[model samples]
Target: MRTIIENATLILPEGILKNGFAVCTDSIISQIGEGPFGKYNDSDMVIDAKGNYVSPGFIDMHTHGAGGHDFMDNTVEAYLGAARTHARYGTTSLVPTTLTSTTEELLNTFTIYEQAKEQNTDGADFLGLHLEGPYFAYNQRGAQDPEYLRNPEPEEYNLILAHGEKHIIRWSMAPELDGALELGRLLRSKGILASLGHTDALYEEVTEAYKNGFTHVTHLYSCMSTITRRNAYRYAGAVEATYMIDDMSVEIIADGIHLPKSLLQYVCKFKSIDNIALCTDSMRAAGMPDGEYILGSRDKGQVVVVEDGVAKLPDRSAFAGSVATADRLVRTMVEVAGISLSDAIKMITRNPARILGVDKTKGSLESGKDADIVIFDSDIAVQTTIVKGKVIYTQNNNLKS
Candidate 1:
């Protein structure tokens, strides 16, 4: 099947193409150019984009769940609902994240992930699993279940690897923890992204971990550490170390609430667009009304409240997670961070795809890439989303066939 999207502004790799068009053939992009495509062939479906911006579909690298379902639920229904909910916000692909938990429960969730992928819920594609915790610094555990936090235990990680590392794209841990560098090496050997998060590591510790394979920093500035004074001596923390290391990459929640606009702009200015990726890090409360809910697995999660569209700890001390969708990420980057639309789009699309090592076929609207695309109006509101040449979401209607 072939579908042509015409009369739109396309956000392409080179730059923005005003009044452009793109042709999709089955599951791949066939052509993209400016002006009218001229008289095209028959047996094709044409869409009048009405000058909306056509961009590569947003790719969310970190998202727990949405639509009132948590991925840790270990049910196919929960995975599907989350996928559909994010698709409505232009997330064509996402990494289903897992909170800190016991090995048995984690394995069960991975099994559910395999099942969900095979079923193909027809929303955003589940790229792979992102094992977020069970190996983190107890002091900076943030919303994770602190009771289950511990250092990197070889036995547990070996068991997870035995389950097959192919199903996992990323794992986050505190680099300062004992035996963490060894675990980072092992994860790198298995082609997994070792990210630093929920930690109180200083600049030197982060540097040592980076050399061993911790190449990414998870949810920058959220649960991670920053500069502070000890005995009247200032020292660079994990956050500052990430900025200094050119090879180290980081992902931000970008909900505007997690970090102030000044911080967001500062990161962009220093880190460069290529090093940053936007993530939701959202929980089940996402896409649902404001209320109280659990932050991790339902049976053993921490109590959290959703107020003013953001999730917070029960006592309103720290953020539990974000309720933001992908579109919201883009909007916050543009409106609050004062970045260009093209750069903001790259943070969610091309940058993430590159980090996950799926850029060759997933990120851009270039020819020969997957036909995952999103059309949004000038205000950055998603109007239609196409995944693999099929329409998956539309603003006018709920979801597409």
Candidate 2:
């Protein structure tokens, strides 16, 4: 049976569609256009959007967890809880990120991730795992457990490849570190996205890393390199290099607290929405009341505190993570950065989907793509979320699943 969402202001790739309707046959968007798409048969389920702005459901490529559940829990329970929490905010798909931990721990995370994907829970779909650590620059390691940080080791990586690379979609590391570039090439060859992050890599180093297949940057402008003086000489850092490299996609925490509004606008000025993804980078603290929580694995996690709308290290020297969801990210882009709704939606949808290599199936509201959609009012508040062509969440009904 076909489901028709009529009377919507569609936010399409090219522009917006006022008084439009979209047709979803099962899980794919069969058609979308402006005007009253003709009268549908009773077999077709017609849902009125009430003239809301409809967009593709957000795809978060970088996130830890939410609802007091970390993905590192090594259990299906954590995955379901976190996924459902983010889905409530319109994330139709996401990659569960891992913290710096033992090789054994990372493998377990991949195993749990595979289980979640296979189970196909009602929350946002899981693409794969984002390996955020165990390969990084120790000096720039913010909120990451320093004990687990180190340069890339081939022996360990080879073991990971042999065991869990199939479940790994992206990997973040410090490009300047020894053996890191080789690791990036290996990850690329295996079809995993190699992202630069938690580093102090210079422009030249970053260029080398990109050439070696580090095509993405994690949490741009945070824990990344920028202008710095070295023995009276000023040099552009990885941050500037990312801006200069047109094709290197980058993600921002976009919760307004992780980065100031001016900095967010500056990033927008330099990078197109095509290369910028808005990620929550949220942790277990997200969707939970403000308080102290763990940032990684249960047995040996980093203690962090949530205050003033963001997570921070216990001592307050660095930020632990974000307590934001996808809706807050979209809202910040529109209200704080003064970005247009269509362009802002692109940041959370098309851009991340493209970077994560799931665009063919997930991003955009187009014919033949996955019917993952979100409908919102003028303030960018999500009124309803449709995942895989199913209305899984709604604001008016106070429903979440």
Candidate 3:
């Protein structure tokens, strides 16, 4: 069946088009224009958008879990539950992120990824899995399990390649670790994205890693060094690498609690919207009440609690993660970070899609692209989420009443 969403404020990366209509056939957009699109055809389902903002469905490049389910659980229910929760907030596609864990645990999680890949559960499309650890520097481990942190081993990489499905899109590693550059080169050979994060590497080391095919910086500024007059060499760390290299995409957790509002604005000013990707980096406690939650594995210990929208560990040293969704991240960028709505939307959608090398199919609302769309009211609240022309989430007025 075909669908025509009329009278919408179409939000695009370039700009917004008012009173536009998007026509989708099967699972791809067929047309977009400013018009009534004539009378709806016999086979068409016409939706009155009522002046709401319609944009490409968000693509979350980094996210752990939600709705009381962590990806580290390595269970089908956990993955699907997180997907459903994020989909309700306007995310159409997401990478299920994993934390530092043992080799056996990672292999077990990959099996779960295979299962989730095979099944479509009427929620956000599971783009792939993101391995965020086991190959990081222990000093900057953040919320990752310190016990499981280690240098990348070729045999372990080979094992992951053999058992892991092609859906493993990106892997995060500390470039300074032994054999990591070689592992990064191998990952690039297989078309998997290699990202640098959770490390205490200097500027020269980061530049060397970039030359070896590390094209992304995960969660910039967090678990990374800052530039100072006394520590200028350390400034050449991930932040400098991200700013200097145009091809390198940096992920930023826009939740106000993770980064100071002033610093977040400064980053956006240095890096164009095209070079910055917004990520939730959320954990199991996202979309739930404040309480203790687990991150990597059961044996890794509990993550801190959520209070006043900030997730902190018991010692208050660093943030465990965030409870914000992709939609909320965009909104926060606009409301707090002083960014335009269109630019913020691009950070979450087109920018991340381009970084993951899936922009042609999933990013924008261009003709011939996947019909993954989101409709939200004026207040930036998600009203409906559509994935591949199928309505996955719709607001229920009865519940609200």
Worst 10 residues of 1 by lDDT: 392-401
Candidate 2 accuracy as lDDT:
0.88
- Arranged by lDDT with the best first, the candidates are 1, 2, 3
Against the unseen true structure, what C-alpha lDDT does each candidate score? 0.90, 0.88, 0.85
For model 2, what is the error of residue 199's alpha carbon versus the real structure, in angstroms, after optimal superposition? 0.6
Candidate 2 residue-wise lDDT at 345:
92
List of clashing residue pairs for candidate 1: none
1-401, model 2: which lDDT tens digit per residue? Answer: 68788889999988998999998899899999888889667687777788888899999998899999998878888898898888888889989999888989877777787888877658888888888988888778888888888888899899988888888899899999899989999988889999999999999999999999999999998888899999999999999999999999999999999889999999999987789889999999888899999987677787899999999898998888999999899899999999988888999999888888898998899999999998888877788888888877876542211
Model 2 residue runs over 4 Å out of place are 396-401
Per-prediction TM-score, please?
Answer: 0.97, 0.96, 0.95
**Candidate 1 similarity to native, TM-score:** 0.97
Per-residue lDDT, model 3, residue 42, is: 72
Report the C-alpha displacement of residue 147, candidate 3, in angstroms. Answer: 0.5
TM-score ranking from best candidate downward: 1, 2, 3
Which stretch of 10 consecutive residues in model 2 shows the poorest summed lDDT? Answer: 392-401
